[model samples]
Target: MLQASFGSQHPSSDARKVADWALRSHDNRQAAFIIIDKRAARLYVLDEAGRLRGSTSVLLGAAHGDDTVPGIGQRAISEVRPGERTTPAGRFLAERGHNGRGEDVVWVDYDAGVSIHRVLTSNPGERRLARLASPVLADKRISYGCINVPVAFYETYIRPMFARQPAMVYVLPEVKSVDEVFAMAASPQR
Candidate 1:
């Protein structure tokens, strides 16, 4: 709507609604915005004016859901159950920061300890990288509620936009209705 071009058409109406609403309503339209489609296992990046910068496959939580345990973020991974591993759906004001491992990441839900980082290829059994490359998005769910993307994509697009300025993130809901998770007035029909 701002004379900018959008690249991916994969985001559902819910995701697109939230992104559009943010661009039109949020005061800081100059900053970057991101939309993560959990159902699609895709990440969409856009400029402040709503033009798509790039998009790529991503890995999400192993389980499917839109809510996280109240204090699961602080618990050790070993103690967390499989079903509890979920990426919450909502709007997040993401910022860039370094994790304990000294690797750069974009914290989407800080309180939930959810962040977007380069895909980890250390665990060959998990086949994380292979999952991301799979044509079926359902294969991409193998992380611990964190979003894992390609290293080049993160360094090239995500880090630059979020490292300097805060960005908006909309994680589309998979188990709940968009209205239930994000009550923003949806974009008007074309």
Candidate 2:
């Protein structure tokens, strides 16, 4: 494992680059931050000091786009089409919140109904848990828009870190350049 910033082992270059940039820029403002690498289907949780708190495989949107469909969040789940389901890529100030079922979640994009919560096993057909364990990247893409993480990871790392405070969540884009998504790329170096 390649040792990156703050003792984190990042297997993907995109994830490492984003984490390094965020720390170098103080973009997180000393708050804990999360980097969700879409290509790798991995989630890295870091503390305020850029220390890796935990890492895990996660489930993302079924589609392979970076922008959310207009008014998709406002639409009922049954009304959302497959193509419209996307997890917009960018930096999000996420906070602890509850979903419709009163389950706690880290609200990534509240208006877009994009949040990071425990994996949903309600549908046996989805095979969310199995997909998470699968080696194929395609198997991981099976969520409406929200991010699904393991239950233990949620309780051990995510819940405790954001239970009382909001944090930054940088979701790497699969279709757009990082510079296009993050304005910090255009700013002068510190």
Candidate 3:
């Protein structure tokens, strides 16, 4: 069996609960796994054995919710209505790739145009870096649906996490309980 260890500082209360269950489960244990806590605006990267590899703040969708809007990915960021933006909460077999912009990223839910990549600096007006460095999670919610992360953090942690294989990404729900999103992954025998 794989061993486990905690690497990041204490996670949010809700994150702790879901992580507790994830720790007990074995389904996603053989591969690198990531836990995106939208409510806390944090992402925790864990190793194949469930040991915490790294953790960093992340920028999520502008709207607060657990589901992604259908067809939102086809439209321009300006065309998407406010509520349509969401970093859907669920499991994803995320893989690495180069976006149309030629930037390397890990697509969490490609159909929804949701991917985790370095903070977008193309639009300085977005003030993405400032938002990510802010002392509050509220300011971090500015993306359409993608999870924006610091370049250093993305390179140092995220990229390496999925370097060898496709990692499982678990985006914890903000609108729903952890039990709801991770019900199947959380087996009692775990």
Best model per lDDT: 2
Q: Could you tell me every candidate's TM-score relative to the true structure?
A: 0.91, 0.92, 0.88
Per-model clash counts, in order, read: 0, 0, 0
Pairs that clash in candidate 2: none
Model 3 regions lying over 4 Å from their true place: 1-4, 185-190
Model 3 lDDT-worst window of ten: 181-190
Q: Write the per-residue lDDT of candidate 2 for residues 110-161, one digit (tens) a residue.
A: 9999999999999999999999999899999899989999999999999998
Q: Model 3 clash pairs?
A: none
Clashing pairs in 1: none
Better of 2 and 3 by TM-score: 2
Q: State the lDDT of candidate 1 residue by residue for 45-125, as single tens digits.
A: 988888788999999998899998899878888888889889888878789987768988999877778999999998899
lDDT of each: 0.82, 0.86, 0.82
Top-TM-score candidate index: 2
Q: RMSD per prediction, one decimal? A: 3.7, 3.3, 3.1
lDDT of 1 at 71: 92
